[model samples]
Target: GGRTPRIFKIMIKRVVVINMEEINRFLNGRGSISSNILTGIMVLNILIHNKPSKEHIKVGRVFYTNQGSRSLSGGVEAWQGYFQSIRPTPRKLMINVDLHATAFYESDSLVQLVVKILNKRSVDDLRRIHDRDRTKLEKCLKNLKIFVTHRGE
Candidate 1:
């Protein structure tokens, strides 16, 4: 008697650009590759959520908990802001976490598999399956929240 919620499969690709000038300035000439990678990952995470623009791409310093050191952090936010400002409609972004990191390593292949799954079924078909498995999705979402919150604290 109840309507089913839609299950949309999402694929995300990220690009990271590091500013050497800003990094050197922030670190005062003391920086490492791990620091840079963590900074990039933070920026990517923020941009995916906020979606900035091109004009705001100038590099600057920002703090990140994961980096544990000073490094470049502000450019991606600026760029995402600029992009969002120009876009006619807001973009919806979703993130999928891979426990095994296999999706990160084999992104293209994993994306193709997702696409294939979606292409094989219509939206209505997915809704029917979701309706049949409502408890499963709800349980998974609940478990995910618990897992993330546990790690956060």
Candidate 2:
């Protein structure tokens, strides 16, 4: 009755690699910290693949949109091109909105909509969102953290 197939997980170390002083200097001398983090990650990604390393073929990025239900629908066809440009399965990619900043004429519907999305799929992590857009999202994360702690995970 105990016929569970073994699942293998190979862990590779991920690091920023740059010294804190260099990072701080680069970031402080340039633009925002968030922008710097993105740039550094991109550089690491480039470094990770130098030759014909066929291990990882595609990169999965979760794009964030601050706009909720009020975005202009024009030229949305261009998004299809962006989706087609990515090698990974489109299902693996996700876009998350700032739930706190999302405004609707009906507040109840907004909350319900957010909860529905969370139930339908894994909610994207909120650590990278702007500080102003974090209250409701942070509250959700804190509550989930508590629940997970209680569940002994």
Candidate 3:
């Protein structure tokens, strides 16, 4: 008898944020404080992956994909390229904002938290739980100080 291939389901969650302040800072040649923070989150994800192998974990891909017209276009293009490279057959995308992080700390803080979560898990294991119940997740995340806007399903 032939053995069945052990198929693995990976769910990759990604968050993208666009902050005006960060864009202004970058354009003015000033240190992009917000951008730096966002970068930190991306780095954190990589760090999370370092410990566990990719086969056993799920990851959330988060970043700021829109800032302004030009910036947003660039970000979207880059992300589209990246998504295609990954080749997610039925990609599920969600948008969320950390009320506290973005409102108080900075947009980057929220981005960082997302990256941290993504890095620890494998794409297959990363399930999009938000789709099941947007309002419920919204309420849960809101209470936890994270606010999200669902853009795409």
TM-score of each: 0.18, 0.21, 0.19
Per-residue error at 4 for model 1, in Å? 1.4
Ranking 1 against 3 by lDDT, winner: 3
lDDT of 1 by residue, 8-123 (tens): 99998666566644444444434444666456446656675453233222223211121122222211111111111111112222343321100111112322323333443433
Model 2 C-alpha lDDT per residue in residues 66-102, reported as the tens digit of each score? 2333432211111110111111122232222221222
Better of 1 and 2 by TM-score: 2
Ranked by lDDT, the better of candidates 1 and 2 is: 2
Give the number of the best model, judged by lDDT: 3
Better TM-score candidate (1, 3): 3
The lDDT ranking, best first, is 3, 2, 1
Residue 125 Cα positional deviation in candidate 2, in Å, after optimal superposition: 42
Tens-digit lDDT track of model 3 for 1-153: 999999999998766554545544554566544655455445544555453343321223322222221312101111210111111122221222221101111233444443333332433443553454445334434644456656573
Q: Lowest summed lDDT over 10 consecutive residues: which window, candidate 3?
A: 79-88
Q: Local error of candidate 2 at 137, Å?
A: 32
